[model samples]
Target chain A: MLQYVLKRLGIAILVAVTVSMITFSMIYLSGDPAIALAGETATQEDIQNIRRVYGYDQPIVVQYANWLWNALQGDFGQSHYLKKPVADVIFERLPTTMLLGACALIFALVLSIPLGVVAAVRPNSLIDRIALTIAVVGQAMPSFWFALTMMLWLGIYWRLLPISGTASWANFVMPSIALGYYITPAVMRLTRAGMLEVLSSDYIRTARAKGLRPMTVLFKHALRNAIIPVVSLAAVQFGFMLGGSIVIETIFAVNGLGFLAWESIQRADLPMMQAIVLVLSFFYIILTFLADMLNAWLDPRIRVM
Target chain B: MAERVLEVEDLCVEIPIPSGMLRPVQHVSFHVGQGETLAIVGESGCGKSLTSLAIMDLLPSKAKRRAERLVLDGDALTGMTERQMADIRGNQMSMIFQEPMTSLNPAYTIGNQLTEAMLRHKSVSLAEAKDRAVWLLEKVGITAARSRLGQYPHQLSGGLRQRVMIAMALMCGPDMIIADEPTTALDVTIQAQILHLLAELQDEFHMGMILITHDLGVVARVADRVAVMYAGQFVETGTAAQIFDSPTHPYTQGLLECIPIPGKTERGAHLGSIPGIVPSLVGEIRGCHFAGRCPYVHEACTAEDVSLRPSLDAGHEYRCVLSPQAAIANRNKQAAQ
Candidate 1:
């Protein structure tokens, strides 16, 4: 088990390094960073001075090494627009995004797992149709549109929520719903399909033949096996929620890393963009690693392998 | 006779599909006494497994199981609610399935699956259940039983897992066990061992067993009574000796002839075979279900339904148009020709 975990961790580190390298290359890929940093009116000499000051004149290998060394120490350089340390700006906004991501995931699982199980338990029944309709609507409607509708009704009309700030937990209700509901369809469908398959398995027959309570058979035996793949899906969705929160953050003024990313892109703050992309990519890799571990723990077949 | 552990009468299972209502098990009835093994032998899709599942009240949701009476030790299972049936299941009666590789939950440890039934039905503590699990596992011939408890299903081989399944079925100490093709998925060598273990355990526990299988050899070796089923009905049923020695029904006789008789059958000669496939049970099924395949099939055979009729021997019966004497004379005439 320990060796499996160590191996997963090694792969995770390899992925993070590749992501970091890609994030670092984004600056070069977008043409000269010095030219982008300097004003359009600036002469060649001005561009050269900017390049020298930022050490862009050095070979690409040395430049990458220096940036990687500093990034290793959490020194992500300064934001060109805000004139603040990139890491500070990113870390400051990270908590809200993380909290939002966690809540969104919780809401998605809490709402969809039972729905999926119920739908699967009695397929083609009324409740199953209702759940399927909800899933279809959730999948069809765009998140931004859903967010706007919620903001209009809950924030403007009903005065039920504070829709545009991260002052309290209540502020996240609309955004989380919009973000979480978007992926609920996939998660719920996977769960329903999985449960349907697992519920028909010989083990479930054995479980029923054992005279286990319906709840025990459904939750303990059937769900435990069915939820394995869903766990990995949920992890991937969580990573997606974190990265895709840019639109929601923009609309609600949550001021998370997503909003920071939008601002940096617009203002040509390459350092902040690099840090945000790298950080989010790292989160994605780490989440996938944890999911692998969790799956291995849940299913012994994977553990022995 | 020993005390009757189970009495099922006129049990029918019908499944409705897009085409029509499919009657897979038609008015099948049998009883099993304490410590007796009544093996229901048939080809695949002959509704043998469905009969066992119907008795256990575990049919698919859409499939309707109707029975005149399903009594387990004086308890009427037909009218019991699902909750009441659940209480009786795995307590008064339990089942063992064919595929041990898939019968045990992969995510759970052998210990959890073994003890869960006992824990649910009895008021015993977890420790007590665990102890019973260990004892049962060892009784089923699994060595290092205590260590085997913590291991998951995939950790064990097919044979070992089947032993665990047998141990699990015995955990609650039910009076009746319905083993549906229990050794069908086992290795050839392992098949004998599993059968031996089951026989030993049944003897020790004195539980009435309904052994469902397609293996005539298994039925001959272990079954006290045997029911030969065709399509959705029992074509013949009697003491094992009667069915094997003097199979009166054309279907039963044909089945026995298919098996090679060691030195009796020529080494390179053609083996016996019953011509034609089983008829579909959809819509209305007239006459004997095996009429198409029976060598003596006549015009009248397909004109009406065939029901089980008694032979000269007590408790022996077969479903055929001809009388026992006539059927035997006809077989002898054919053999002489």
Candidate 2:
């Protein structure tokens, strides 16, 4: 197990490096950052001075290597527009995104598992038909569109909820729903398929023959086996939630890493953009690693290898 | 004779299909005397397993059952709710399934699975349940029962798993056990060991058992009474000795003849094979269900439906168009030639 963890950590470092290089180079793929930062009216000498100050005048590999080295030490240089440390900008906005993502994941799990089990238990019945209908609608509708629709109906038409701003817990309700709704279908479908497969296994029949109640047969014996596949799926979905929080954050005016990343792009702040990309990529990698470890712990067969 | 422990009368199971309604079991009736081992023998798809499932009230939710009576120790079980049936299962009546590897839950330790029935139906503390589990495991001949409790199902071999299943079934000391092809998935040597274990356990507990299998050799060794099923109905039932000595129904005769013996060969002794497949359950048949496969195939055999009739012996019974004297004469002549 220790060897397994070490091997996974080694792979994680390689992944982090690749992600940092791509994100750092892609920010430069567009027009020159100095022109965008110094404005059109600035003189040629002023632009050159700005470029030299930010180390852009150096070789691309040298600039990248320096930036990566500094990033490893938690120094992300300074933000061009804000004129503050890049790490400060990211730190100021991380909590809101983490809260929204966590709530959305919890909501997805709480709603989807029971719905999936009910659907699998009574296939083609009224509850099953309703669950399938909800799954189809959830998958078909995009999160941004769903958020806008919720804003229109719940905020504008009914005046029941706040429309924008992430000031308090109330602000998280609509955006979390929009994000949670989009992810619930995948969880529901996976759980439904997994539970159906387990319900038909020979052990479940033996459990029933042993006189276990139907609910016990379902929740105790069938659900544990069914949950093995769902754990891996949940990990992937959680990573997607973290990275995909951009649209929902923007819609809600929540100042998260996604919103910060968006502002950095408009201003062409290279250090801030690189910082946001690196941090988010790191977050994704860490989450995937944690998920792998959790899955191994939950199922010993995987750990045995 | 001992008092009857279970009486199943005219039990029929109908399953709906796109083609039409299918009757998987039709008017299947039998009884288990206290401490007696009644073996129900038939090939696959002959409703042997279905009969056991029906008795346990563990049939699939889609199946519809109609029975005149299903009594267990004089208690009615025909139309009980699932909860009530559950109360009886594992406590009064338990079952051991065919595939030992799959019968035990893979995720649970052997001790947990063995103690589940005991804890569920009886008011035993966890410690007491554990002790009982170890005791039962040792009774089934599993070595180091205390330590074996911590191991999972995959850790044990096929024979050991079957013993675990038997121990689990007997944990609560159920009055009757329904063992469905208990040793079918094991090797020949393991099969003999399991069969002996089941027989020994049954005698020690004085428990009634209904062993469902298609193997005549198993029935010959373990069964006190035998019931031969064909096309979803019983064609012959009698003492094991009587059925082997003189089988009246053509299906039973065919089944007995199919068992191969080592180092045995006779001229014109074609390995006996039942001639035709079991008929589909969709449509009603006007005549005998086995008429298509019977070697006799008399014109009257196809023209009339035949129900069970008593043989010359007091306890033996069979369902056939031909009288017992004719069947015996036919068997004697075939053996002589």
Candidate 3:
């Protein structure tokens, strides 16, 4: 197991490096970085000074090497607009994003799994129809619209909860729901399909024949095997949630990494944008890698494969 | 005391299809006595497995089951609630299914599944359950029984997994065991070994067993009595010797003839086979279910249902129109004339 993890870590480093290379090049792909950094109204000498200071005169490979070496030493340079370290800017808002993401995931799984299981238990029943309808609605309707509706109904009309800001739990209710609603369908549908398949397997029949309690048969014998693929799907969805939080964050005024990312892009803060992209990509790759390993551990057959 | 383990009468299972209801097992009746091994023999799709599932009350939720009576240990199972049925299922009776490759859960260790029923049905401690699991495993001839407990189903070979399944069935010391084609997926050698183990264990525990198989050789060896099933009903039933030596129903005769007798028949002799198709189960079945497939099928045979009639022997019985001896004589006389 240790060897397996070490091998995966090696591959993860290579993937992270590749991601960094791409995000770094993306900023350079647009108009001259020196002009963008100096502003459109800057004089020619100012543009030259900015270019020389940032080593834009160096060859592309040399420039990339310099940035990469500095990045390894925890220096992604200062954000042009904020005049602060890119890491400090993104990190300041990390906790809020993490809290929102975690709560949304918990909410999605807690509600969706049972719904999926109920639907699978009695396919085409009234409950099954209700779950499918909810899944379809969740997948089809945009979260921004859903967010606005929640804001109108719960915030403005009922005054049950606060509309904006992440000051307290009451304020968090709308944003979490808006973000979590989008992925509920995927988790629910996968659970239902997985449960359906597992419920028919011979082991399930054996479990029934053994006279296990109905709940025990469904949850213990059936759900464990059913949740294998769902785990990987959950990890992928979590990563998407991290990246997808941008729009929801902007709407809710949750000052998080996603909102920072949006600010960095609009202001063309190249280093800040580069740092956010690199960090998010690193998280995505690490999550997928961990999911794969967890999957192998869940089912030994995959290890051999 | 004449101990009766299981008794079923007029048990039927019907599933709803696009065209309507399909009766896979219709009006099936049988009884199992203590220390008895009744072999239910039939070809594929003959509803043998379906009968066992119906008895276990584990039939597919969509399929409907009806029975005049289903009793186990004098307890009527016909009207029992699912909870009541579950209480008796692994406690008083259990099932050993075919295909050991899939019968055991891959996610669980052998010990966990084996100890489950014992723990559920009896007030046993965890340590006691583990001990019983080890004992049962050793009883089924699995070496290093305690160590095998930690292994998953896929970690073991097919034969070993089957042994584990058999041991699992024996965990609670059930009064009855329904083994549906227990050795069908095993190699011939392993098949013999497993059957031997089952027979030995059954005798030791005095457990009534229903062995369902399509192999005549398996029936001839371990069965005390044999019931030949065809398309959801029994065509013939008698002592093992009587069913083999004097098969009255054409279906039973054809099934016996299909088995090659190595020492009796010539080496190059053409193996016997019954031609034609098994009648469909859909729509109302008005006659013998095997009439269309029987070589001696007369118009009278297909006109109405034929129920079981007693043979000359005190206990032997078969479902047919002709008397046992008369049917054999009539066929012989036809050849002479």
Q: State which candidate has the highest lDDT.
A: 1
Query: TM-score of the candidate numbered 3?
Result: 0.96
Taking the tens digit of each residue's C-alpha lDDT, what string does model 3 give over A1-305?
56677788899899999998998898779979998888779999999999899888789999999999998888889988999888787788888888888888898999899999999999999999999999999988988889988889999999999888988998778888889888999999999999999999999999899888999999989988898888889888888888779989988888888898898889988899898888788888989888888877776555532
DockQ of each: 0.91, 0.62, 0.69
**Model 1 TM-score on a 0 to 1 scale:** 0.98
Residue-level lDDT for A225 in candidate 2: 81
**TM-scores (chain A) of the candidates:** 0.98, 0.90, 0.94
Q: Better model by TM-score, 2 or 3?
A: 3
- lDDT of every predicted structure (CA atoms): 0.91, 0.87, 0.88
Residue-wise C-alpha lDDT for candidate 1, range A92-117, written one tens digit per residue: 99999999899899999999999999
Candidates by lDDT, descending order = 1, 3, 2
lDDT (Cα, tens digit) per residue for candidate 2, span A1-305:
67778888899899999998998897578778777778879999999998998887999999899988888898999988899999888888888888888889888999999999999999889999999999999998988999999999999999988989987788888988888888899899999998998998889988887788788899889998888778778777777777678899899897787888788778777788888878888988897788777766655555544
The better candidate by TM-score, 1 or 3, is 1
What level of docking quality does candidate 2 show?
Answer: medium
Lowest lDDT 10-residue stretch of candidate 3 chain B: B328-337
The ten-residue window of minimal lDDT in model 1 chain A covers A296-305
Question: Which is the winner by lDDT between candidate 2 and candidate 3?
Answer: 3
Judged by TM-score, which candidate is best?
1
